[model samples]
Target: MGVPRAFPHLKMRQRPVNISNFKGSTIALDVMGYVVKGHYRMMKTSGLADDNTLPDSTPGVISSVEDIVRTIVAAGCVVYLVADGKKLPKKAKEHAARAKKRENDLVMAESCFQLGLKKEAKKYLARSTVISPATVDSLKGIAAKFPGKCFYFGALFEADSQLGYLAQNNLCDLVISHDSDMLLFGCPKVLFTMNTKGWGFYYEAVDIPTALGWKKYSYEKFLKMMILAKCDYVKNIAGIGIARAQKIIESSPDLSITSILKTVTTLFPDSGIPDDYATEFDEAYFTYLYSAIVDPMKMESTRISPPPLDLTEEYLSFAGYVHSREQTLDIVLGNIYLDSGRPSRNVTDPSNLDELFPPECFFNSMYEHKKEVLEFDVDGWEGPSPNEDDDEDDERPKKFDCVECDKTFDCLSRLLYQTVTHTNLKAFSCHLCKRTFGYRQTLELHMRIHGGVRKSKCDICGLTFTRQDILTNHMAAHNEARPFQCDQCPKTFKTNSCLHQHKEVHLQVRRYQCENCDLSFKRIRELESHKSTVHYKARPFKCDKCEKDFTRKDYLEQHCLAIHTSERPFVCEICNKTFNDSAGLRKHAAVHSEAKPFRCDICPNMTYKRSDHLTRHMKDTHPAKLEEFMAKKKKAKRPPATSTEEPKKKKPLESTSKANIKIHKLSPQLAKLVGQSMMSQIDIVNKINDIVEEKQLYDPNNHLYAFGDQDLVNVLGVLRFKIANVFNLLNRHLE
Candidate 1:
């Protein structure tokens, strides 16, 4: 509602002026704004009651208000407390909408409280702030108590408009309010956030032009910019944000609604400017510029009265009558006049009657009594009765008993955890899987997998998810708004979990260790997959046609397309020849480019289309070079060899560096099938080529491998490295 991004740009132009600079000046105070602000500040400092309701008048609120008022008077400024009256007829629609939203928020807050989500409940509760009759009565009581303070309750308009009218008519030199709308209301000067220390921000109307770098800046121009940037009155252009709207406004000399629209459309053609934008803009511009403000001449005259000497008693009496507690009254009075030579009371005594009466005590006594009765006779039925040793309650820790297991614990959290794990207290069960869950939300999430019920759908990609939270996370990918940033690097992520996972890379904490082998992974999921594929030899994904098994689903799909089906999805652009996959097409396209990217470091002239080809060139042409490469590779592969290690513990020469051996012109089918085996692509390729050469899959007459039958193909498809064991296993199967 305030000018969008207005303060960030204007901060450089802001001049720090103290309250002493405004001595002898008259100021119109937005009394309700200060009251609301004070109430929230009090609620924050003083913890909320057990029932989560804010205390009507806290010591903090009274002290803060008194301090502000005292500071203004000491500055020699005549202060008028301006309160909002009835809503304007034109604003009634907005008022009703706001009330409806507040009601919804209150309902959600209550729901969250019932669900034990205290933090979320507090957030919703904060959004439901409203000025009730009690608030008005309290403000009136304050005004009545402090007679010297001039108080004005407007009859037909908001306090902001009335304050602006008074300032414009020279009745007040400055308007003091937290509401930024005071500036838009044509108030000449305004002071904001005045604390007890006589410190606050001073915003002058004359500085607007210089701050915005627009010499011709007027109230009308400012209102138009607010409309374009989106105020309560107008819906902004779909893709036009505050910065873009400012640019549009600054580029045009004439700040008419039509001219602004035309300029925006011309400059940003992709802004998705609506067809009825002009109509909406005109309405918002008119409402802000003309309809919103009250005429200064029509407003009533403002006057300041002298304060009564007996104001302290009036405030003390009012507090006692309203709160019905003498202790609260004492605290309020002490805070109100603490700096005015008045003796203050100690409000921190835990044994005080007011402090002892927690909000939960009023409503939860019956429930507590029932629980106490149940605790006494766990195996038998009993009626509720008062505990005789209630005076000694503070001496011992409260006990919690798990009803299902008949187990008792000193804390409710321990009992609840035990109940979930060791008892049949899980009421929510999945229909399909017959699995029980301790919570209803958990059961609902599990049901999504079996029922295939996905209600939340993304608008852009039409992808659906079982949960709304999941769908919200998915939408972040489309917008590319990574709000969770890494402290170690420039990389940002859409979710906190992603950021947490990325942080482990910097820590290098490989916590998930494989039990069968010494290999470890950073994530538990990766380690589990490794164990299933390598150690357990589980091929869960099966090709439908040939019944060939694969460790991964992607591998099974690739096998079906490359071997079983004649589908060629990727086509070569130069020759128009087609292949089964992109890798095959890339190999074919390399012929058209006439470039050999893979080259041997030892021999500069030796290059090939495939890495395996370059490897064979290095091995066959230079045996000594191959041996040197193998020795270095073997040393790199082995863990740091201990000096005192036994000869038996040392790696056998033949068992090491077998993956380093190379083969030339390997078939595309073998490349993809081996790629899907959950093994390193480079190592697996070399190992497969070794097996093929040992088994004689490659023909002497042709450069390509010739598969004689389906059995031979199947043997190659299921090939994995087991040192010298791989060739013997393939020979036995093929023979």
Candidate 2:
């Protein structure tokens, strides 16, 4: 259930105490453990009876429950019974595994029975014990008989968490449960194995960390240790038992699972750790720390019934067990109360239990409170009582004021909301704009404005809006959508502002007029922008690098790229040259290609690379033909106004340019041979062969021209110089 053998190792120093020691104290009872123990006791005495005859076990079970309750009540202590709820979500796999184990145990028990090992068979059969639904119903009926004494949580809640909550909140002086996990749940004090005899060991929450020799280990560290030891959710690491786990946890610099795993792998090289061990550990850790449980306030709301001395017939009948009145009374009243020779009191009897055993008596009985108080002398000293100003304070109305905004509210909650809204204590903030909002929903709405995220789409026109309300308003535009009508005209518009603008056209009104110029606009923002840029020459947007400014922020960004930055993002595949923009690269590509799609209509042979070049040629050569060509171009480009058409697509760039041909430079000797030949200026290669043959300078073995003398070297030098000049001219034309 928790860390195995963790209780004995972490138990506080305890001594034997009698039932009278806990008089007038409030104790929380773990009802599930007592019920299970009682059932087991009944089964042992009745030789493990079948389901049909199990009702006979109810008296013994009821006897056990009453024994524990009466012992605590006889000592003048209050008992609040807490029962476990339905199976926990985190324990689902464990529950299934347990069921499988029970099945195997049943098989083993049957095998043992056939082997004539009756003792071994019974042990195996006991291992398969399960609490039936009928037993649970019977227990619930018994609890109903004593109203306000029991609490049942939701189906998926844990009883230990409720017990811890009650103890931690001071609702109970100590929790009485067999579960050691209550220590991890932060119960300040817990009494374990508390039975009718009142002989049990109690552990204080502080004793755990102290016994573990932890300097800074918190509740979380303790939980991590429990998880490492293989709790209900997590599997144990092979070769890493409780002792090794404690060492690993204590020696680890970081308590995180990742850090712990790293240290474990280093320490135990032979132990093979699973790859998904960290993930499993995380799941277990979160389940233990954050799984839902019964609220402490809800536990407090449950009624507490005074201890019952006599048994009720309704409870006896519901139990379905045939027992005599004397036997039922004995079962309801434990040996501690009955054997003490005290007469049982009826429910109708007048008695003040609080007066009989006060809380001060219990405090005095504790061993820790055995020391006597030392008296100090005080001469002529008087102090005001805590309730001295209560009369004056009660007359005034309660008010809460925000410290930051200096605003007063009727309630503390309102003041807290206003304070957080005004202060920078907001949870949500925008990274781009550096703006903050008090609520996440408000921040989400603001993000939509920045991102232009229009998720709500209109079915009619496919227009979208960031908000549902705006989308709903836009839906009206599909059919009889235009409700705002102009009085002067029959035309209608979707919005009142649109109708007002249309009416202005009839009235010939220009609401926005420039102060410096005669320019007028329907909107004031446009007029202000024009006046600032053209009249005042004001540039609000400035570049960070060059200190240059522009009226528009977009223009300032463009200026930064074009002037300050030498970033050539566009490349010409034809020439392998880079340009600042795609437009520059397109114009540069025209030099390498011969295809000119734009042609003159007047002259069939005359063509231009670009449409603008064709227009320029037409205007320069023949002005009359230019207008006709432009009219034809416009007619060809025009589409029907009713058609929702897309813009013309750009031509895909060629991967490899056909005009890219490599040229080689002539060697000095080859240049010399060409210069000496008569056809050197025309057919250079043929001229070089003739010159080599005439001069007898051709090597027959290598088929190469050889320079024989100093005269040849001088002639070759002059030829090389003239060849270089000619090559330069050819290179210029290629470029």
Candidate 3:
């Protein structure tokens, strides 16, 4: 038989060491937390964080890494980076599920933040190294940064129940969470404190025993208790609690869970069988135990999680200044260095550049320094020796393999990262979930499914979810969570309630009527709504008629070509039925489809009119094919004689020619219609109010322009000039 797997007892010794003892600590953070934030920010606009009435409660737990970094740095610890191996590329998918769940607005923002952060991190990263779980490489970016610093990865000990059992067995340091389940799991020294700062942290460390507890669990007994309670993952006991389960297990010890299960089955033969009952229970229980005992591997271990924080708390005064710089390349490199914990020397100490000597003086200084050694580079000023060409004839560039591309290339990390990460390269894949990741840390998060560390879970439904903030949004749907009320209607929603409530006016019974026009609407919102309310869209849909704006392109097209482009495409094949429009052709085709649509009001005259005429003719005259031929013979079928020419069949143009041709024709009148600017009306009121200046047309004394025959003509010319000038000004302003 194959060796059955045995869960290991993974435990650590609890030292309760002081923070001062670990002064030179180096921490390696996985980027899972940061990626979560990136993912969250990318979704904020997708109705996820909508509502001004409530504070923004978006998922940004991952970004908490930034704070961790600052805290660690302030504590005088050196930080190191270790990139997990890139995941292998995955198959191209037409229906990428992650892509579908994403909103258009967010994808771009996430991309921007991820790119910027990655670039900045690369600049001052004291040490850069790559490591893979498979390969036994000793090098680590964090370890390399400070060779002597004590190494501690943030997730050194995970939330594993078996580990808690082991911690109990080992009298380990407190589990820093408030979950009561740890007590049942057998974790000793559960400390409910270890916050980021202040005297409480120090006090807890010095007085550790006050928060500490002793070990208490017999493994076999604990397992038996869990099973009897129907709490062991495999069973489905509808109404069992810890207290009831303890009594059952207390009454019966040394009973194998499997045997107990068999007894229950025999006693209750009619009970529904659990699907894969044995397999299911064993898998869940053992799986949980194994994760506690084992450390999961992550790709690109170098990334740090994002700062889990309130945006207002982490706000910056000078957020973005790199874009405006004298030297763009320098600024980019400088920003990268700053983010990576390095301050540029030039920016810090300008005097290091030195007083400007003459160019020759500077050159001479360099020459003097070199000459002081009494050696010159002139010996190597020669080109390749003639002897080298005779020995071997090779003048090609040397090749190097890139880990990212898996191809030979020049050593350009930027190009490699771009080709591999920015594109659809899957550098990491989660063994548990089968999800691809750019790096291993991301995959590490996915692997957490196997470990069962649901840090972020749904609170409202008690359903465990992966992302914490996603649960926040889901909870909003459960109650009267929407506090923002609409001004126009009784309806209330979390966001955009006002606009939507106003839109409801269009649907209500018509109440507001346009006094000047016959048109009326149920609500004032709709009645007051003008075509220009489409604002930006209206500007883009320039009409091809007298200078005008339309909210849609189809409407603009109809206005432009209604008279000239009104040609019918659909037609009836029988009786040569045709129509100038599609509506007529649609009506005519129904006649053929139904065979006859006309009804005869007279006796048997109800037959199709065409058929009735034919029948009458057949009875009155010869109706045979021979008679039809004779009738055709009586009429002369003349050939065309105009220009003595045959009507040549028109051939379709070549594909290239068709592409070159413009399909639609726009009349000058249509062009004029669209040329009118949307802004022309905007500046009129302001312009009118600005000027009380007297014009020749306006009399200062009468406040009116009374004109003679010649004055009228002059006034007409002035109006034309003013209108033309307005259009010109609008064109300039728009441009």
Clashes of each: 1, 1, 31
Model 3 C-alpha lDDT per residue in residues 169-239, reported as the tens digit of each score:
33222333323334334444332222233001111222222322213435545554454444423445434
TM-score of each: 0.41, 0.40, 0.23
Off by over 4 Å in 1: 57-63, 88-123, 145-149, 274-276, 292-735
**Model 3 residue 404 CA deviation in Å:** 55
Question: Which candidate comes out best when scored by TM-score?
Answer: 1
> Could you tell me which residue pairs clash in candidate 2?
148-303
Arrange candidates by lDDT, descending: 2, 1, 3
Q: Best to worst by TM-score, what's the order? A: 1, 2, 3
Cα-based lDDT for every prediction: 0.55, 0.55, 0.34
User: What is the C-alpha local distance difference test score of candidate 2?
Assistant: 0.55
RMSD of 1: 24.9
Question: Which run of 10 residues does model 2 get worst, by summed lDDT?
Answer: 298-307
Estimate, for each residue in 1-735, the C-alpha lDDT of model 1 and write its tens digit: 355665555552244345666776666788777777666545434445877865554445555666677678778765666666435443554677687667656655665455454554555566677544344434444444444443333222356656765665566677877766777667777766555556566677777777777867767777677668765555567667667777898887688777887898788874656546686666544443333223222222221121245534333221111122332233222222222324323222323423432322211122121121101111222222112211222433377555556678885446544655754355554543345676555775776654556767898999988666788778888976788999999999988878998887665445555544555566766775665567444454556688577766677778888998889988888789999977788667767766788777777887888655666786788877887776665555444423343422433444333333423233455445454423432345345544454555533322122323344345443322222123333323221
| RMSD of every prediction | 24.9, 35.0, 31.3
**Which 10 consecutive positions of candidate 1 have the poorest summed lDDT?**
369-378
